[model samples]
Target: MLSVYGVAPSEQLFKGTSEAEFPAFHGRPVGGPVLVDCKVSIVKLGSHALGDQQSWVWKPVTQGYAVALENQPLSSLKNHLRGLRTLKDESGQNRLWPWFDPRYLKLVLRGLDGDDLVRLFGPVTLFAFALENGVELFSQQDGSLQVKVVSKC
Candidate 1:
């Protein structure tokens, strides 16, 4: 099974459910919290869904709105991801990190060192993102990061 997380820019573009979704806040909240509808959501994809929408899903992924990872248990993975939602910046202030965004993900994969990558990846054995004309695959081997690109045919 593959774990997929995505964000819809607008409500009209959102077709998924709110079952396992959360709001994407800009920064740390100040006074009383204000609630608003969010388009961010997570879903698990099995072989059947992947087989059917392999072409469909890849397009949006290439546009940097979503991402996929493998080998982590659902509950644990969700918790792990939740833990990563906030990051401390240079000034030691909490900031929202949309790690699921493919654009941000690409930067993270390239910027982080081996040790950081290991922690960031956690139990995810494989990570994939679609490019303009190909798919980028990331994995770890012998304490190193390995990347491969499969061009669309």
Candidate 2:
């Protein structure tokens, strides 16, 4: 699993340390919350305190730079989400493990423009996308409430 930062799905984390807009830690906003998409394979499930897991041998997923395009929001229609529903793959081909929880994350993509997807996302992948300190999400939703997108350390 890999983590990314940015509004557009194609955008990735800052190339170098000096280029990171935020601290790469929780509770920090690097940009305005405009729908950031993260990989579920980057998370460590079945833990009390789930922290980010990165490794030297483990590299982040490559940007599906060639297959990404913004479409209509997934919730725009009733059960429309079920129309092109998917898990794991960037576009419904990638399947996720059972240990992961969709309640903690979201699959509200599709509205995002692009076709490039994560060709090789690891099992530990997870993400904390577009959110504010006080973003309000219903109990039915995963992750924190509205995320605040601001520059972090």
Candidate 3:
């Protein structure tokens, strides 16, 4: 199965290297307490068999942006989270595999605002997105997070 590795960006190892040199990787070590070390299957991103299971629907908001809405107002994501559990032994960690429905995962992720997206898909996946958008995260004076797009990647 294709996997998503969350490789950390090491300053000591890649300080002067270009973005192209950052390894294209996925997944993380298994059986760890922290979720940043667990691998998630890319196959989970495949379309679902139950077409209506989608919790979010997107509509174009602008030329390059779209907004997602919950398919049902009463059926919030918190209810569906009960079905999203990690392996029997992998409790206390955030990695959910073998049981997670990618569709629902997408919905939950879509529901999260900018500040909540810091750990979305772990560092490597976020790094890939930052690289694509030429953006990086920074802390504000008030302790809030912000996205800063760099002139050069």
Candidate 4:
């Protein structure tokens, strides 16, 4: 399974590196110029270099600066996430949905059901993130959201 992380710019996970080292792309569409500082980035994970830097990265990820997804090609997963960036509001206006942020993800998950929930999961078979005391894992099973919480030992 391929593991990918959607990292928010505030985390600065790639501050001192060249794009070739981490190979990240913004979540926004490809046709226009956008502010890189304000966009969410999609990056592949599990490299030896990343493992070495885990100490610094882990805390930001746990604090909602990133989200993990598994079992999808990088390009496909990026497209899926980009599509979810904006949502129609109650008044029919498009609003930014910061669903990748775990704090917002918890709230977004609560209000999604049936197709809405399934749509969110899309091609990603598993979603995982860390909370203050545990890691939350989300998977779609039998048309519903199934969550597993692994507490810190």
Candidate 5:
């Protein structure tokens, strides 16, 4: 369901079946790749939100950065996004938006591929269960939407 290596799979990094990929990465000082629990850390950003890839288009609603994202501006968000696409765990590799950033800030994912869905996750958006880590952006203009993150824990 996620990438443990924080980036796309390198042939060197592809240790086993794809089914085992986790959501986070941990590199050993010795060399090569290793997977870590990429589980989403439970955080309440409080009752704050804004327009995202999922709802209200370009507008502000009950919006505020999650506590984890406090003061995290667009540049900070870009830094976080970079981490997702870089795979230091592998012998060698690079790609655009290879992995997912678990902690999201204000910016939206602009050009996610329909197939490479790891690029589409965000603090806002809804793609059904077909998509992972979705946050529905709701507006009075768009009726009601609910957000739910199931804890694999």
Candidate 6:
């Protein structure tokens, strides 16, 4: 389950749900009071680990700038990550590291393409499924995670 949380450019993108809220991690680097009144887009990369919240943390950027990520199968995401990693920067060095390092993944994610952004994170696992797009997941104040439909206009 790859969960991408962001303030959608417009509220009209979502259907079935009229609004969604992004809990403000104020004082945090990715802090936000993100409130989507109309709708927000949610993309499902694939099935992932059921527990462990740390594995789901990706970049700490705000909506339209970054994505909240969850893990997927390495076999499905490796090629995309490798391709992004091989890209050269202004200094002519590999833009990303060849190895998987959680500490550095956030920085690397900032440089990924939108299409590739779907699965820019996750634990190095083999049991996950292939990537797909559809339902969005969110946690309620009661500590339960729920799913909603997301679409782009």
TM-score, prediction 6: 0.26
Candidate no. 3 TM-score = 0.22
Q: Tell me each candidate's TM-score.
A: 0.67, 0.19, 0.22, 0.67, 0.23, 0.26
Cα lDDT tens digits for candidate 5, 36-145: 22322211222222222122111121121221232334343334444554433245564232233222221222322342233333222332111233343311113233
Off by over 4 Å in 3: 1-99, 124-153
Worst 10 residues of 2 by lDDT: 61-70
The lowest-lDDT stretch of 10 consecutive residues in candidate 4 is: 16-25
**lDDT values, one for every candidate:** 0.55, 0.23, 0.26, 0.54, 0.27, 0.30
Taking the tens digit of each residue's C-alpha lDDT, what string does model 6 give over 59-130?
A: 221122223334544333334433433345678864333222222343444455443433443332221111
Deviation of model 6 at 113, angstroms: 6.5
Instruction: Tally clashes: model 6.
Output: 2
Per-residue lDDT tens digits for candidate 1, residues 4-89, read: 54433333232444335555556443222422223455654443332223543323544433335565566665676677666666
TM-score of 4: 0.67
lDDT of each residue in 73-147, candidate 3, tens digit only: 212222332333443233555554422322333334544455444333222121111223232222222223333
Off by over 4 Å in 6: 1-75, 95-99, 111-153
Model 4 over residues 44-120: C-alpha lDDT tens digits? 45532222224324346544333345555666666776776667778998665554556566667667889888888
Q: Candidates 4 and 6: which is better by lDDT?
A: 4
C-alpha lDDT of residue 120 in model 3: 36
